[model samples]
Target: MTTTAAAVAPKPTGSRTAALSFAGTLRSEWIKLRSLRSTVWCYGIVIAITVLFGILIAQTASATFASGGSLTQEDQQSYALLVSTLGIGFSQLVAAVLGVLVISGEYGTGMIRSTFTAVPKRLPALFAKAIVFGVVTFVVGLVSIFATALITAPMLPKSGITPDFGDSQFLLALVGGALYLALIGILSLAIGTIVRNSAGGIAASLGLVLVLPPVLQIIVAMTQAEWAQNLAMFLPDQAGGRLYAYAAEASVTGGVIVLDSLQGGLVMLAWVAVMFVIASVLLKRRDV
Candidate 1:
């Protein structure tokens, strides 16, 4: 009886095994992210889209110049910026979907129960997953966006679109494009956490990032209301789009709101912050 009691006895608080470090949790999440086939495919697609779009736009611009087209300096800058970041519009949808899958897949397969069981606190696992996903997504975005720029630069010189690598605005736009992608992915991850179902999460993610923008634009066009236009400017896609928009004189027309790159970035961060807080709260209070 005494031997059995001792064998089953709980260890003292100090002797209990230490909870897994955040670093360990991060490493585990990274492994899970990279091991998934969907992650591989989504990232591969992002790179491919960036390069292809760059090539297409570069060729189009070159041909136009060859046919006696002309552009002012501002137009040239805008055109170059467009070629560098146009892939962002298409790739962001993929990022949002991947973000949903990262968490929603675990929930679907019953793996989240195990993940929460291992972490016990739950929020750490959520944070770790977000951190890992955000970092990898950012790196992938950075590489693809910059690589496309370099690859397309030589194609543009014949058209008088010499890419000035030393241009601060140009560099910032490239970095901002990557940062926008990372934030978009994180925002979708938060939405997935809140929804907790793969289909619903993806639909909601894409709906916010994709559908809502166009719908709101239509409303603004039909109504021409200042409020509608201003509200549209705050949507995730609208604000994030400004991140890579060619820098120009900051001006607002007719009481409508216009966000500079920095303001746009802050608005996007606010969206992410609000969504993440909600997700963290729900993940903690709800049952896995």
Candidate 2:
């Protein structure tokens, strides 16, 4: 007790690590996406809905054929794409929710603070999340649509419908489906960033994806204006639908009902770009 004071231990030096690179942020986002139970359930629902609708439509088409009704090659192809993709509109909503959750859930749970702290550069977090959601949803959608098409092929004979996946139209449909879902996912991510509340994000995303198009359609009908129809076609859903057109009719003005497939893809990209810009600005300005 009288001899010497105990030597005081030196505090360990804390190492400051550099901020996470963009790739690291993307990996983190992926990890977060896959760790959530809801992600798995939502993806499963996408596949299930796609397959179920495909089978149902194929069966119905088969019955119609069995009744001796004639279906043209074009009609058969349209039906194949339509039936397999019937769930697309609904699946977009599911994707929207998933997208919203990816960002908003972090905010709701206060995990965003940790994310921001680690990344420091806020925009990368948002970008990384967008990329993660876009890629995941796109791949999932592509696989679902492809599988649905395959399943529907057997039923096609009953409908007097034969589809070749090797065909150009079928290939376009597959690619378009993937792009459409990816766009929807990105749109939802932007809204989630803007709203920050999960419910608000989901509501706004769904409203844009579903509600707005119909409202625009009604307005266009009421107006009976050429410009209105042109404008309405640019809406995200309508523009995206243009990519899968097999039998588009002429509008009242004698112009084709469909936009060029390349143009339609560009239009969809424009929507994504606009929202992405807004989201980036908001994310930069707002506190976590």
- Highest-scoring model, TM-score: 1
Global lDDT of each candidate: 0.91, 0.83
Kindly report which residue stretches of model 2 are placed more than 4 angstroms away from their true locations once superposed. Answer: 1-13, 68-70, 247-257
After aligning candidate 1 to the native by TM-score, how far in Å is the CA of 143 from where it should be?
Answer: 0.5
Query: Number of the top candidate by lDDT?
Result: 1
Kindly report which residue pairs in candidate 1 clash with one another. none
Please estimate how well model 2 matches the true structure, expressed as its whole-model Cα lDDT.
0.83
